[model samples]
Target: MLILQSVAGLLILPSLAWAISEDRKKARPRIAAVGVVSQLVVALMLEG
Candidate 1:
């Protein structure tokens, strides 16, 4: 759980940056999808 939390925190940076974006809304979704997948991978690694 702790490892998941830390990995989630790392993923938050890109989202926060995305949130701050004014004109790049379209690209944010793609970036977020990638972030989610990355977090999933991190969690999987912890489980394995």
Candidate 2:
């Protein structure tokens, strides 16, 4: 579980960087939402 969480965290880093680099201001919110959902899914999957 800890390993999964760590891997999830690592995976988010590139998405975060991509979000920051995006010139389309509108896409940021979507990217952030995806990131949040991804974390929640991983957490729930691990916890349950």
Candidate 3:
């Protein structure tokens, strides 16, 4: 779980930087998708 969270955080960090640099409204969906996938990964890891 910790590893999965760490990986997700690392992935999110770049997207967050990009989102901050550009218009957030346009990047919302992309960010959300990343979040969703990260959550799914964490869930799968925990279940397995």
CA lDDT of every candidate = 0.76, 0.73, 0.73
lDDT of 2 at 19: 69
**Candidate 1 residue-wise lDDT, 1-48, digit = tens:** 987877777778776877788867466577677877877798789889
lDDT, candidate 2, 9-46, per-residue tens? 76776566766785745556667778777887987898
Residue pairs in clash, model 3:
none
Best first by lDDT, ranked: 1, 3, 2
Instruction: Residues 1-48, candidate 3: write the lDDT tens digits.
Output: 997887778678767776677575565667667876887788789989
Top candidate, metric lDDT: 1
Please list all clashing residue pairs in model 2, or write none if there are none. Answer: none
Q: How accurate is candidate 2 locally (lDDT)?
A: 0.73
What's the residue-level lDDT of 29 in candidate 2? Answer: 63
Q: Determine which window of 10 residues in candidate 2 has minimal summed lDDT.
A: 22-31
Q: How does model 3 score by TM-score?
A: 0.44
- TM-score against truth, every candidate: 0.45, 0.45, 0.44
lDDT of 1: 0.76
